[model samples]
Target: MPTTATPYLLRSNTGKNSLKGALDSLIASHINQLGPSMLVQVEAVTASAASLTGKVTVRPMVQQQDALSRPLPHDIIHNVPYLRIQGGSSALIIDPKPGDIGFIIISGRDHTHAVTTRKPAPPASFRQFSMQDCVYVGGFLNNGPDQFIQATDHGWRIVTPGSVTIEASHIEANCDITTSGDVRAGGISLKQHVHGGVQTGAGASAPPQ
Candidate 1:
C-alpha cells in the first residue's frame, strides 16, 4: 500500500538498481500520474440551492498500488467542487447524498482561478492532475430512482408510482386529446373541474365554467 512516506513508483523497483532500470521504472510510473477521472464514493455533499454552489467530500474508490501491490484506501478528499449542470435559464438540480457513488474528472492543470472567476484563467497552482483538484458529478448510484423524467425525440414522459405535483401560477398545455391527455385521477376525468380557454377540437369536451 502506498503511504505518505513511500513513493508509489519506486515501490516495485526490485528489478535492479542500475540507472537504466531506474529510468524504466520512472517511465512506467508516469502512467498512473495523469488522472483524467476517478471513481469515487460520496462521503458527503454541501449544496446551496440559491446560488447553486457547493462542494463534495469523497473517497476514491480505487486504490493506488504500493511496492508490495497491496490495496490501500485513499484519504477522504474534502471541499472538492461539485459540477452543477446548468445553462442560461435552466438548471438541473441533483444534489448527491451520503453513500452515493459518482465520478470526479481531473483537470490537466490547476483550475482555481478559472473556477473563482467563472471564466478561462491561468492555473493558480503548479499541481497537475492531482486528486485535490476534482469536480464531482453525481448519479452513479448502485440503485435506481423510483421516479424519473425521460424525454425522447418523439415525446416527453414522467413516470412515478407516487403523485406528481406541478405548482405554477398558471397551467396551460396544447395537445391532441380526443382520446388521451385529459386530466384524470383514479381513471376519473377532472375536465369538469378545469376552467376555460380550451379550444374546440375533435372529441374535445366543452370547457365548463
Candidate 2:
C-alpha cells in the first residue's frame, strides 16, 4: 500500500513562494471588489449650464457575482459624475440621454469631497475601489445619427434633417454660394420678384451710378 500525502504538503504551494506572490494571491481573491473600469448603461442624466459636470445614474453592463458564486443584484448607481469636452466659454456638450450606453472608470479612493467645491482635495474616506467612485464617459451607439457635425482630414461637414435657426448680428461668406431654394434678402425673393419699373422684355437697362 502506498502512503498518501496530507494537507501539510499543500502548504508548499503557497508557503514556499515569495511573500509578494502570497500577497498577490490574497488580493486576487477579492478581485471583484477592486473596481477599475466597467461598461455601463446610462439610466438618468442630470446636468445644467451652471454646473461644471453632469451626473448620471447607471447600471453595470456586466453582472457581478458574490463570494458564493451567486449573481449579485444589478443595482442602479446614482450621483456618478460624467465627462464633457469643453474649455472656457466654448463647449461641445454631448449630453447623454436615457438608454444610451457608456463606460465608467472607478477611482481607487473615495472622491466625494470634490462634489460641491469642484476642486481637488485629499480623499475624504478610506473606501477604495468602491462603485461610488466612478465617472461616466458615454459609449457605443447602436445606430447612426440623423444630424451631426463632423470634422475630419477631408473637411468639415454639417448635416441636419430638420430646420435650423441662427441668431447673429452680422454674417460673412467668402466662398461661392449655391442654392436649391430661393434666396431671400430683406423679404425679397430673388427667384420670383420684380423691381420697380421692371417689365418682362428683352430691353437693356443703364447701369446705376
Candidate 3:
C-alpha cells in the first residue's frame, strides 16, 4: 500500500502547473489502503441544452504521451488546480499521479469556478453561495434539509442544512447539483437521499469498497 501524503497547496492563479498535475496529486494523497477505492471525479466540457450544436467527434491523442496521458481506472482523479482556457489555439498540459482511483474532467460553459475541497471544513460551516459552481475541497455529510448546498436564482449555492456525514460521501468536495451536467458517482451509494437530478454513466461506476 502507498502512503498517503499531504497534498501540496495550490495557489489561485499562478498557472505554474498544468491542470492535469493538480488532478494527479488529488488522487495520490487520498487513499492509502489496499484493494479498490474511489479517488476523484472529473467533469468534462460539452455543449449546452439550448444550443444547436452539431459537430464530428475528434479522437483524443491516445498515442501521444508527451502531452496528457490517457486517464486510467487505476489512476486517482484530480481536477486541474489552475489553468484557464481562453480564445482559440490555447493549450496546456497536465500530468496526474499514479493510483487506482479513476479520473474525470469538468469544464464550464459561461464561467468556471473551482471550489477548494482539500481544506478541512470549518466547524458549523453552512450557507449558500452560487449556482453552477464546483466544490473540490472536501465532502460534508449533511442530514439537515435546510443545511445543504442549494440552487438559487443567481447561481448554485451551499446551504448546510445540518451536520453532514463527510466520510460516507465520495469526492474531496460535495457539489450542490446546480446545473444540468453529468455527475459520475461511479455507482456510489448515498447514505442520505438526493433531492433530484439525472445520473449518467460516462465512466465505470464500480462497486464502492
Candidate 4:
C-alpha cells in the first residue's frame, strides 16, 4: 500500500497556502475602489448665505487598502456642491455640517465638474408619515415652541403639556362649536340668541314667568 502523508505535513504546506489565498481574495473583493462615487464623512462645510448651494469638504470613509492590508490615505475632496432636490413645489436642500456622514457622487467633466452629497440617515428620534408628508417628534423642532401631537391608546390628540394660550387677530369656525368646559368670550354674537344661560329655538315662545 502507498504511504499516506502525515496530517502535520498537509497543514504545514497545502492548508496554510490555501488559507492565505482565500483570505487575500476576500480582502481584495471587499476593498473600496478609487472612483468618483464613494461613501464619505463631512470634515467641514461652508454654507452660502445668499443661496441654498454651498461647499463641503469631505474625507472618504471607505478607502482602498495596500497589499500589506494597510489603509492608504485618500485624497480629501473639497468644494463639493451641496445639491438640492428639484422638481417639487418646494425644493429640499441639504446643508451638511461637520461630522455629518453622507454619500457623494461626482458628475460632469472638466470645468463643469461637480460633486453631489446627500445624507442617508434621518435623525435618531423621529417619526415620519410619508403619505401625509408630516413629521412628529419628542423634542423641539427648528427652535420653535414645544407642542406635542401624538396618538394615545384612545385616539390622537394635540396637546400642550403646560398652560396653553392662543393669540390671533380673528378666529372663525364654520361648524357648530361644542366644549366640555365653561367658555368665556368677549361679547359673543350668535345668529340664534341665548337668554338666561339657555339657548332658545328660533320663533319659540318664552315659558311663563
The candidate maximizing lDDT is: 2
> Model 2: per-residue lDDT, tens digit, 1-209?
98876555344455527665677677886894788687889889898764667899999888878779998766889999888888887777778888888888989898989765779988889999988988998767635778889998998988899977776998899999997998878777878766555557987544221
Cα distance off (Å), candidate 2, residue 93: 1.8
On residues 1-209, what C-alpha lDDT tens digit does candidate 3 reach at each position? 99976544453443538565666566665542212212242333233332322111111222223336665333222233322333455432222122212322222221232234334444223222211222222112323344445678997765563543444554664755454533335454344324333358555554443
lDDT of 1 by residue, 9-106 (tens): 56655667865577788888897688768789889878866574788899999897789999989899888888767887677776777888889988
The per-prediction tally of clashing pairs is 0, 0, 33, 0
Give lDDT for model 1: 0.78
lDDT of 1 at 39: 88
Give per-model TM-scores.
0.66, 0.75, 0.13, 0.38
Q: Compared with the true structure, what per-residue lDDT tens digits does model 4 show for residues 1-209?
A: 99986765245444435865566666775552213455677788887643656667777777768889998877877666655555645654445567666666542222221122234433333322211111111111133335666789997777675876666898887988676655555554343345453455666554322
What number of backbone clashes does candidate 2 have, counting pairs of residues 3 or more apart or in separate chains?
0
Candidate 3 Cα errors over 4 Å, as ranges: 1-72, 77-79, 82-103, 106-146, 149-209
Superposed on all Cα atoms, the candidates' RMSDs to the truth, in angstroms, are 10.5, 6.5, 28.6, 13.5
Candidate closer to the true structure by TM-score (higher is better), 2 or 3: 2
Off by over 4 Å in 4: 1-36, 49-52, 111-209
Candidate 2 vs candidate 3, lDDT winner = 2
